[model samples]
Target: MSPQHRLTDLPATARAVIEDRTGPLTSVDMLSAGLNSPIAARLLLDDGTSIFVKGMRTDHRWVWTQQREADINRHTQGLAPRVLWHLTGQGWDLLGFEHIDGVHANYTPGSPHLPLVLQTMSSLAATTAPSSIDLKTMPQRMSAYVDDPRALTAFDGSTLLHTDWKPDNVLITGNRARLVDWGWASRGAAWIDPALWVIWLIASGHTPHQAETQVRAHPAWNTALVPSIDAFTRAQARMWESIARTDTPGQWTHHMHQAALTWAKHRQ
Candidate 1:
């Protein structure tokens, strides 16, 4: 991924648009480029308020994710940071969000943050997807990865799903966990989210069985069919394998690829 652009590096028009809403920035501090966004920064306004902003060139391949995050924010209410403003001009698209004062969730075994994360997931699973806009379905997203199309049915559902559960996308506050980066949100079986989390838990030091045991605390997991979970594990393993092969092969991707494989094997 390309390095994030400093706030000063924004085009004049883009800066003016942002400053108009923010009342001029007192300082611009760049934030970590979590997962997919090219530009992630925290803007401190002259009024002494701060907001987290993420942006990218208007024509960038992942530009749609910015729009998705903004569109999906309304449904995420208590689960994520609210979108403060959106700007599209001068060849850039940016979104300013209510800055969350929190730290990335720890998924390691026995971490206190795990229960908080699960609580948020259960809240999210109860949400209905916005029918006004088209959202991708998990089955469609994984179809290319699985050999038997029939297995994809296990993933289909109407529930709103934050498909990517990477720890960076989850922030642990004092008593709750707030999800971030909704670009990969999708419509899928409620249990699918817990299944996705399992791979990350394994990567975070939980044995596959231990990870599954943890997610069983989720109501959705109790309703999931064993074969369906098996199908998802298999598809996930193949999907990550493809990602590892095609996406510059980062260490994290390779690690996740292995994690998925381990989960898949444990299910067999």
Candidate 2:
């Protein structure tokens, strides 16, 4: 991933955008974590307030994700960081969020944080997708993967899903886990989110069967149709394979594809 921009590096116009909403900035601390975006930092204003800022060049291919994240944050009341403001100017697209002081979740087998992560997923599953926002459906997203068009119907639903389950995207504070990075949020069957997490569990060293057992604690996963699960598993494998082939190949992407294939084989 490219190194993030320092607050001092922001152009005058971009700096003004943040100052217009917040008071004069007193200090800036750039966070060096996360894989997406070229800017991620904490802005400290003169009034002793702090906000998390993330942004990318407006002309970049993933620039639209800034707006998508802002829209999704509006509907994710208790689950995600609150969006304080959004700015698009000075050749950049930026979002400011309530700073969350928490540690990234650990998804390793037998970790105590697993139950809290499951509970958070349950909370997200109960939220209906906001009708006002244009969102992508699971089948629409996986159309390039599935061989049978009929299998697509199994993924159709109105439930909101945070399809990216990387450990860095989940923060555990006290007993609750908070989700961050809404760029990949989608509308799909409730089980889809948990199913995505299963692949992450496998990447974190759990066998496919063991990961399935862990996710079965969710009601959606427990009652999921066998055929629907199989279809999604196969579709996910293809999706990862395509990504691995097209995107810049790396160890992480390669491992993720392997994990998806591992889960698909278990489903068979």
Model 2 clash pairs are: none
Model 2, residue 149: C-alpha shift (Å): 1.0
Name the candidate that leads on TM-score.
1
> Where in model 1 is the C-alpha error above 4 Å?
1-13, 247-250
Where is model 2 more than 4 Å wrong at Cα? 1-13, 247-250
TM-scores of the candidates are 0.94, 0.93
What is the alpha-carbon RMSD of candidate 1 to the true structure?
Answer: 2.0
Q: Rate the local accuracy (lDDT) of all candidates.
A: 0.87, 0.86
